[model samples]
Target: MKIGLYFGTFNPIHVGHLIIANHMAENSDLEQIWMVVTPHNPLKKKNTLLDDYHRLQMVFLATESFPKIKPSDIEFKLPQPNYTVNTLAHLQEKFPQHEFALIMGEDNLNSLQKWKNYEVILQNHDIYVYPRLNSGEIDSQFINHSKIHRVGAPVIELSSTFIRESIKNNKNVVPMLPNKVWEYIDHNLFYKK
Candidate 1:
């Protein structure tokens, strides 16, 4: 089995996320996409993140009906400042039978070289990059890699940062997230200032 590991904090799962996962699952060689619930991303600030378990729960609730997508808590038990290289290594060890690939947005592609042992990742694992806002116009000449593949997915402008700020300001975030996630956020007061 071939799996695409879509890593993210998923502070609150939104429609845009589901759309991407669905699009990839339908179009890619991947059999399934594991929503790797990142406990703490090395590149992101820790203070801005919600509790890992809370974020994981939101992913679980939002992707419940989607068979091709699953919530993975693999990073919760791993070391702090989670790095993609470490997570991929651990997952490969745990699920040796399944071939794993990295799934990310093109916005992160430019910074890929900064990631720990990024060269090793490019050599060993396949990468599926979705188009990001304003990056679609980039010429195909810029993308030159046998390991990298571009996905034809809808470019969604929605972001978790926007949703978090809305909650902090007491703005309605119902449209930003799924119904279950919105209810959970409202009930638990997540991101409240």
Candidate 2:
């Protein structure tokens, strides 16, 4: 199987995430798109993040209706401050029979050089980059690379930060989240300040 790994903290899964995953699964060469819920991202702040289990459950609830998409907790079993290179290596070892591609946004592509062992990541895996609003043009070096493919997925400006803030401020977030995810957040009183 050819799988596209969409890694994120997914503080809470939102519609924008589902749209991108569905687009990749249907429009790209990937047979499956796994939403790898990172326990903690080395590059991001953790203060506002929900617990790893809650975040993972949100991903599961949001993606349950989509057969091509799956929620993964692979990073929870690995080391803290999870690095993409290490997770990719572990995944390769565990699933040698399958081909793995990394799915990321154009914003991430702009910062690829700063990631640990980015060279190895570029050399080993296929990268499917979806467009993001205001991410600017991709650098020429990556634009010409054989392993990097720019996918024409819809660029939704929605973000987990926005959703969390809306919830904290007692604003409605139903439009941004999956119904079940919104229900979960509502039931658990998550993100309430």
Candidate 3:
């Protein structure tokens, strides 16, 4: 089995996340896409992040109905300030029979050099990149690489920050999030002002 790891904070697991995962699952040779919910992204601020467990649960709720997509809590048990290369190493060791690939946006690819052990990640794992609006083109060095694949997933402008702000301002985020996710956020009064 080939798995694509779609790592994210998934602050609320909005529709844009789902769309990208679904597109990858259908368009790529991947057998499944695991939404690897990072406990803490070293590059991003942690003050506004929801609890890791809460974020994980919302991912599960949002992806439960999709057979090819799964929500993973793999990062929760791993060391904090998780690095992609470290998690990939752990996953490969644990699931030796399965082939694993990294799924990300073009924007992330632009900053790939900033990640820990990024060269190892590029050399060892296949990468599926979805386009992001205004993200510019991928670097020429990676454009023709066999390990790197560019996917034509729709460009969604939604962001977790935007969703949180909308909810705080009492704006309807129904269009931006999965139905169950929105219900969970509303019931739990998450992102309240």
Q: Whole-model Cα lDDT per candidate?
A: 0.87, 0.92, 0.91
Candidate 1 displacement at residue 185 in angstroms? 0.7
lDDT of 1 by residue, 1-193 (tens): 9999998888777888989998999999999999988786556767768888889999999999889999999989998777889988998999999999988898888678789999888888999999898654443533888899998888988988998888899888887788998988889988897
lDDT of 1: 0.87
Across 58-173, the per-residue lDDT of candidate 3 in tens digits comes to 99999999999999998888887788899999999999999999999989888887899989998999999998888876677787888999898998889999989999999988
* lDDT against true structure, model 2: 0.92
Please provide, for model 2 over 54-169, each residue's C-alpha lDDT reduced to its tens digit, 9 standing for 90 to 100: 99999999999999999999989998777899999999999999889999999999999899999999999999999988887777889889999999999888989999899999
The lDDT ranking, best first, is 2, 3, 1
Residue 172 lDDT (model 3) = 87
Task: Using lDDT, give the best candidate's number.
Answer: 2
The lowest-lDDT stretch of 10 consecutive residues in candidate 2 is: 38-47
Off by over 4 Å in 3: 41-45
Query: Candidate 2: TM-score?
Result: 0.95
Candidate 3 global lDDT = 0.91
